[model samples]
Target chain A: MKFLHTSDWHLGRQFHNVSLLDDQKVVLNQITAYLQDNKVDAVVIAGDIYDRSVPPTAAIELMNQFVETVCGELGVPIILIPGNHDGAERLGFASKQMKGAGLHILSNFADMVTPVIISSDIGPVAFYGMPYNDPELVRHHFKQSVSSHDDAHKLLCDEIKTHFNAEHKNVLISHCFVDGAIESESERPLSIGGSDRVSHEHFVDFDYVALGHLHQPQKKGEEYIRYSGSLMKYSFSEQHQKKGMTLVEFDEQGFRSATHIDLVAPHQMRIIEGELDTIIEQGKTDPNNEDYLLVRLMDKHAILNPMDKLRAVYPNVLHLEKPGMLIGMEQEMASAKLARSETDMFRDFFLEAQNSELSEEQDKAISDIIKQLSQQ
Target chain B: MKFLHTSDWHLGRQFHNVSLLDDQKVVLNQITAYLQDNKVDAVVIAGDIYDRSVPPTAAIELMNQFVETVCGELGVPIILIPGNHDGAERLGFASKQMKGAGLHILSNFADMVTPVIISSDIGPVAFYGMPYNDPELVRHHFKQSVSSHDDAHKLLCDEIKTHFNAEHKNVLISHCFVDGAIESESERPLSIGGSDRVSHEHFVDFDYVALGHLHQPQKKGEEYIRYSGSLMKYSFSEQHQKKGMTLVEFDEQGFRSATHIDLVAPHQMRIIEGELDTIIEQGKTDPNNEDYLLVRLMDKHAILNPMDKLRAVYPNVLHLEKPGMLIGMEQEMASAKLARSETDMFRDFFLEAQNSELSEEQDKAISDIIKQLSQQ
Candidate 1:
């Protein structure tokens, strides 16, 4: 059985407050093309189908279009699970009826104990989907003493294992923060610190575990456990990470090989740092000039209308910063805060404002004014 | 072709600030039972499936369940359209894909020109659905001079007539205000006055025009042009209106009989009027005491704690009004305004307050105080 594994589409996501629907459309179209060319039998979307619980209408429409094109137009079965970002009940609506169209959205944990079995050339592949479950809900549902995400996942997985058939290949799809997995700023924290992280040892029994909630495409200790990552770079921290889908091929033997297919983004996210004049000159001749940019100016003096000037050259420049000003301001703020008295702080403010210390006569006048105000 | 026609479901509607989801479930369950017992060929929902463009999550879930029961469980085709309260584009999303499951939702003006042909025992019944189109959108889509909803509907119907087939029975399902149709407060006015009213003559080409937007089950000029009304009473004004679904039986020959199937509401809406004491006394023994009540007190004097007392006997009392207070207050306000000067008004207020004319000593004291206040 051959299947395409992907997750965290975040369809209605905004990059630097700009709507990424158009960009998402371009990348999703690319995935559809790949699906057609590869002739993949099925698709597994681990989770995080939307950027927020109540996504924008445009995002809903875009998702509907994508699902229609993939499952309806291409005739490929799609198994989807709700992520931490989705409103599970809302996304789960009409899911039972949608199964006839080959679009399976698994959201409820109680109904998810049974796997959605699909027949393949070799045998049947049982796809077990686990929607993002809060520890409290999991604990109550299973009547277990699970206090953390790791505990909940372990309990749920163990229960699911009981229903597993030894004769067929079993694939588990879930959205969880696996321990030791690389993190990115774009992915929302499932819990504080690493309490939500589930160790890869829990999933050793499964043939393959397609995971989400980590925006880096990499294997976690084992080749069978992987994160397909986000379809596009969602933050500056993710600029170095390669974004793509993971394709896994399986047979009757239960284990199989997995391959990563890189997706081409319409615009690359780049960080460029230099003096204002030099950066502007570079932008004029740079081959990737149209890429969404975060420019860091190293010049000592503050540049006037910096964003305006940078945008004139790099239209897609999303952010501008002066590292020198940031560092200098941080030091100044610390020293200014260290001033013990209001008078001393005022003196420092005067010196900073006028580029000179307060004169003796001026200080006397300020003291007299303070005395008058205090007397009233 | 026999079909169950219903409209103005307003599934997420609230009555007197109270959610009607539980009540809606009861009525919908009744409809489901009717479908099961009668074994209807199909169901036609004219429009207004949701109370608002963006309905609450529970409403979405209810609508999903209803569709699943009818289309998936019962294996019946359902034709739906968008109402004025609905966001047409959002509701229309995935409509093309939904058709495969026998759930057809027509929302766009451009895409709805062609009829959705369904095979029947007699022959084929061409069902044309016209979603609620604003006058501006209608004019732009067809490039016609439509200033009012009436003009828009006329132009659109004329266009639809061009595609009509004489051999098949043509049924037009639309969410529109037909002229001469009685209305209830629950129905939102499409436009000010009667500008939105489209004459029944426009839909003469169709064998039957199942209409919506008027929350009253009545015919407009002709027997074939009718409004099925809402599934439940959404307002006090609709309490007297019979709420039900319309059952129509048709064939290739065209004109057929239509019957109204009354729905039993979980809680009937009632208006009780009389003196507060008398109303409360009556409520104690009334068989319909549990019904949603709108109390109109006819007491000549002010009654304290009327709502609290009434609620003890009738828990569902939603509104309380003293008609006598309103009349007396309006008369007093008009007379009070006749006192042009502040002093004169104060003098009249004193007379009303004290139930006596001012004495010379009091008048002298009032003048002294007014003079001192004016000086300040």
Candidate 2:
């Protein structure tokens, strides 16, 4: 059985008040075409289907059309789980009824082991859909008298392993930030206020783990756990990284290595520094590269109607940043070059702040501030 | 085919912050029991299954239990449509997939004619589900130049008739306020900041129209258009109305008259007007009724902690209105009684004001105020 792994579509996302509908449509069309061409059996949308819980009508319609086209016209099965960004209950509505069309939606903890059995020539393959976990829900689910970051995840792994069969190939779908996965600039880190993290080792029992939440397509370790990354580069930090989906094949032996399908989206984010007129002239010469254009002007004086001028030459000119970014980049590079021993740096900072005397309370406050800053 | 017609469950509805879950549970349980005893083939929930678009998980669980109990356990086909208050696209998510479990959710105008053919012992009965109509949606659905409220509704009726079969007992379910149905305070009226009503005659084609939106159990004229009413009295204006669901039986000849199963929930909504102390004493005698009490205090002075006193006697006390309601009620009654002709009253009043010899500007201002008051 061949499966297409993708997640964090965020269909109705808005970047700086500009609607991503057009770009999203382009990417979605590409994905649909890819699925049809590749003859993918099942598509796994891990989570974060919509940017917000309360999506607009347009988002809903787009989702409906996509689902209809995939399941109705193309005859592909879809297994979707809800992310932290979605309303689980809303997503799970009429799920029991929708099973006939081969679209499986799992949004609750109770439905973790209820796999959609897909029959292949080898045997029956189980596709498990697990939604994003909240620590509070995890605690309540197990009814365990414990308070720790790893407690819930450990329990979830234990409970999930009970339903697994060593005889058949078990593929688990999840939306979680495992320890040590690379994060994109636009990717929201799972836990900001608390040190809540699930060890990547917990997923070792399953033959394959199709993961979401991390927006950078990368492997974790020697294990079969991987993140498919986001559909498109949502931020500048992801500009240097490759964005795409994963194709996993499974047989009687177990799970096989996945192939990363590179996404050729309309826009390729770029950062350039030059005068407005010069950049415009350069963009005009590259007429075929009209899909994406980023112009950064180096001029000290403001250019009137810069957006209008750039757009006149390139309709897809998405970003415009001043040469101030270059100054910031140079400063960052200089800081990175400077090296100081941790102990010496702290002693020098303390001596400078206290002059001749340093109180215990003041020292403790400084240490606390340093600890907070380091965490950020 | 015997089908039970019901709507406006409003599962998570709270009457002024008072949880109606208990009442809803009782009503829903009774409905399940009625279905079992009567041996109904199908159940039609016209619209407004949930009070809000994004209902809580508890509400979702309750809905799941109900669907599982009615359709999953009993094997009765339960059909649903979205009402004005519901998010149609959200409710309709993966609806086509769920058809295997005999649960149908219709949330779009495009699928209005696509009836579910239920093969009962008698024959194949076509059940059509039409969601609540928005004028804008109606215009878009028909793809024509619709100018007025009547035109929009007429187009929908016309479309429905094109698919309507006279030979079979065609049952139609809708969520719209008909012209002559009794209005209840429990209902959120069609408040588009003005009056825009669909004529009652548009629903004449169907053998039965299981209507919703208006939370009043009633029949307009002698035809088969009926409102099953809300499961519980959501407001004081509905205190006089009986709350229940309608069970209808259809045969080869046509539709048969159905019986309304009266539902008495654990709590009953009451409006009691008295002094705080007296009402508290009354509540003590009937402590069980206190939980469902809607006390309207008419004390001369403001009563501090009146709710605390009332709750001590009646735990289910929902509302505590200050003395102003009594005054307002009296003013309403007095205005109703004073039915003098506006023209005659204005002439006599004007003659008396002329005796005072006010300035022309003042007369004009007074006349304007009088005119506005008369219109009201």
Candidate 3:
């Protein structure tokens, strides 16, 4: 049985303030082409089809169109799981009804392991989908004293192994930040608060483990365990890495070789340093002319609507910086301890420009927030 | 054709700041009893199943249970129309799929005249469901150079007559507020500012016009046209009126008699007149002991924790109130007016409470709203 393995579409995502929708479209179109040529059995999206938990209508529409094209037009079964970025309950809404149309969406973690068995020529192929599970839920399901991510994940893997039989081919799909994997510097981690991360040991027993939630595409262990990577290079850190999905073919003899396919980023994001006028002129005649460009002006003074002028030639110009970037400004202010209390600083900056002045009671609330931030 | 004509359930209605859910349940149970005894061929609801477009989850669940009991459990075909109170777009959702389960929901104005034909032992009955039409939409639909409520309604009635053959046994269900009909003070009018009022003449052609929207059960022009009223007396104004639904039964010859099935208000809402201290003292031995009750204190001064005290004896007390009820609050502050302006007020109130002063630009925006209000 053959299937196209792809994940982390992140439909409405902005890469460092630049909309990656066009680049994403380019890669998806290539996947569609590949599917048509190869006559694949199924398309598996591990997780994170959207950037936010509550995706915009446009993003939902885009996903609908893609699913319609693959499942409805091409007649391939599409299986999906919800990732950390997705709201599981929302994604899981009416999933049972949607299954009649052959679009399988698994978001419920109530079942320790729910497998969608596909009847193939060789035998029934059990495609197991596990969404990103919270430890509390895992503990409730297992009814044991599991606390941390590692303990819960190990228990989950052990339970999955118990469900497995040697006769049927079993494939595992998951979304978690795996340890000992290469990290893309520009890729933002799923959670800044440590609880979201799960150890890679959970996927050890599966015949073929398809993983997601990491932008950099690479195999976790031998080739059997893999990260299909993001459809497109989302950031400058991923500029050097080849971006695309992995096509996997599995037979009754355990697993077959997986192939990685590369795709060109539709409009490469580039940063150019110069005066505002020169930067705008350079933006107008750049080789990657249609690309979303971020200009960092070396001039001391801020340019008036530099984005507006640059967009006359390059409509996708996302960001403009005068002299120093926001990160640079933060670094400069790093030595100023307390800084008139963090809330007072915010009240003095963003709100002050909007003609906002806090009352004594409001100031107290703001100061409380500052104290919390200081503790963090 | 044996058919039960009921409308305007308003499942989650609050009357004079009191919940009417228990009252609604009592009425529904009565209707269920009537349906079983009468052995009704079909059930027709003329719209407004909920008071608010986005009803509370409990309201939705209750409505679903009612549908299950009537349609699924009792094996009766149910036909529903969208009312002025309902979000037509939301009601129309999954309607296509729901048709297979014998529950028909009509939401669009496009199906204005086409009768939903249902077969029965007598003959074929054409059930025409006309949703409340705004004058602007009616004008747009017919491409007529008319604006008045009378004119738009005349156009709709013409469309109905033109399409419908009076030769067949026909039942018309409508949700509209018309002139020359007595209205309860609590009834929400279909339109506030610009909508034209529909004339009562529209029902002249039909054998029986099952009217909705007006909570008070009343007849106009003859016994043939009637308002089913609400399942319960939804407001203080409706307290004196006998609240229930009307069941219309048609014979082989066509014209038949209509009977009113009285539904007991589940929990009695009594305006107990006395001093607050007297009522509190009387509560010790006052052994009427109904599960749900609404106590009204005659004391001029506001009673602190009145709900808590009243709830101690009457655990199911929906609301507690002072003697003087705010009159015309529903009519004066129309939903559309409140919906648009309430957000602005909330935002301004928040900023002001924070001691945030508005700039000239912000002040101008606020002034513009004040100007609009002054002009109105």
Candidate 4:
């Protein structure tokens, strides 16, 4: 079976107060088109299907439209789990009834016990889903001691291992911050004060482990365990990420190759760093000036509303900063090129401190005090 | 076709800070048992399936069990909508794909145009649904001037009327507060400031108008326009109400009789009034002390730790009150049978105000002041 692996769609997410709805729609269409062109048998979305537990209406509408087209129109089956960002219950509503129709939402501890089995040319492929469950809730439901995310994941995975059928290929889809995975600013911490990580060694028995929660889109210790990353750049800190999904091919023999499929959204998040005038000039000639931008200026002076100036060229500039941002003292520091007299040093220090030069009368008083000190 | 009408399950709801998950499960099982015994063809839940958009896990588990048994197991088709309490977008997720199966959730304005048709012996029964949408969202989606609930409902109903099948029996399932339906305290107002009521005249054309929101389980101006009410008593003010559902029988002849089916939950919310000692004495033999109780004391004295004492008898007593709850002054009023001396009245007032009697010096001062006032 050829499966499209994706996670952290974070639908209804915003980029610096700008709605990513249109951008998300454009990229989702790309994924759908790929599914059609590539003949992908199924789609595996690990988790973080929505940006929030109670997603915005537009987000819900977008998800509704996407599922209707993919699962209903395209005839491709989808297996999804709810991430920490999701309300598991709401996400899994009518999941059992919808399972036969190709949309399988495996959410909750009970879902872990039963796998959603799918047929392939080789025979059958069993997909086990472990949706995100907090430690306290896990303890209550599993009737075991769960003080950390590791305890929660280990206990669930251990029990699931006993239910695995040896005849078929087992694939585990989960939404968790695996130990030693790269972190990103966009991801909300699963636990506030405690550790929110689980070891990947627990899933070594599975043929393939598709993961989410960290938006960097990297692999764990092994090649089979990987994160497909987020749909787009949700934070400026993730400006360098190659936002995309993964494609996994497997058969009766077990896991095969996992290929990376790059998805370029309508707009890219980029950082433009240079002198104010130079960057503005670059923006005028740049074809994709509409990209979401964070500008860093190298100029020394305090430019009057540089954001406004930058925005005039690049309309999507979200933030701006210069070297000496605190007191605007870069210009004064540059002027101090030689060893100076006490009066000159004192004058420069006074101007920098109080934003004003001393009057002639004050200067005379300072000179008199200096002369007295020198004689003594 | 025989239909079981119910709404406002309010799963995961709490009563006076106590979780009613068990109570809700008991009542929902009652509904399911009714479906099995009566052999109803279809189930129509107008709205408020959950107390909150994101319900508790146990509530979700209960609802999941209910739908799985009712729709997946028993093969009874269920039609539900989102009420004011529900997050429409979340509640209606994958509604389109799930429609082919027994469960049909119509939770948006577009659903108003397309009715979920169920087969009957004579012909088809078209069930048009208008889920609760805020007037602002209605204005945005419908692109019309809808500033009130009246406007919102009328516009949707008007649009739905155009698509009604003349060959079939038409039933309109909605979650709106009709103008004259008596409301219960537990029903959250659809709108806070402005009117949250729609005119029942808009729904007159439908053969049977099944509604939710007013938890009284009563009819509008006409008997055909009925509310199935909630699954259980959600508020103390609804103590006198007979909590139940409606049963509608329809065919080619259009609407028939709408019968009220009384559903007795395990616990009934009731108010017990009398002296504390008398009620306690009665509680010794009152087989159903587990019923949620609100005690209204007729005793004149301030009993020490009345709630603790009351809970010993009626273990579920939620509130305690007396006629003179504010001042604890009923005892003084009761002792006013004789014309007491001025000193006695002053002494009593002083004792009540300070919680202590006048000392020798204070009594002498008060007597001297009264003597001077009398002389004046």
> lDDT scores for all predictions?
0.86, 0.77, 0.72, 0.86
Indicate the TM-score of model 2: 0.82
Sort the candidates on lDDT, descending order: 4, 1, 2, 3
Ranking by TM-score: 1, 2, 4, 3
Residue B365, candidate 1: alpha-carbon lDDT? 85
Model 2 DockQ reads: 0.41
Q: Which ten residues in a row have the lowest lDDT in candidate 3 chain B?
A: B324-333
The residue-by-residue lDDT of candidate 2 on A204-291, one tens digit each, is 8787888888888887864479899888877765668788899988767878779898886676665556787787788778745565
Candidate 3, what DockQ?
Answer: 0.06
Q: Is candidate 1 or candidate 4 better by TM-score?
A: 1
Docking class of 4: acceptable
* Model 1 backbone overlap count: 0
Fnat of all models, as shown? 0.40, 0.60, 0.00, 0.62
> Which digits, one per residue and each the tens of the lDDT, describe model 1 over residues A61-116?
88888888998889988898999998887787667667778888899885577788
TM-score on 0 to 1 scale for chain A of candidate 3: 0.76
Docking quality level of the chain pair in candidate 3: incorrect
Give a tens-digit lDDT track for model 2, residues B1-376: 6788788888888778877887788878988888777788888888989998766667877898899888888989899898877778777876776777888888877667888877876677777788776676677767787755566767877887888665566777888777766777666765464355667688777778888888888887544788888777888767778988888877776677877878877777778888877877776677466447777778755556877887787777777787665676677778875876554466567679776555678667777887899689
Listed in order, each prediction's TM-score against the native is: 0.87, 0.82, 0.64, 0.82
Q: Please give, for residues B283-320, the per-residue lDDT of candidate 4 as tens digits.
A: 98999999998889987667899999989988999888
Q: How many Å off is the CA of A180 in candidate 3? A: 4.3
State the lDDT of candidate 3 residue by residue for B23-97, as single tens digits: 777678888877777788788887888887655545665676677677767878788887877766555543433
State the iRMSD of every prediction, in order shown: 2.1, 1.9, 5.4, 1.8
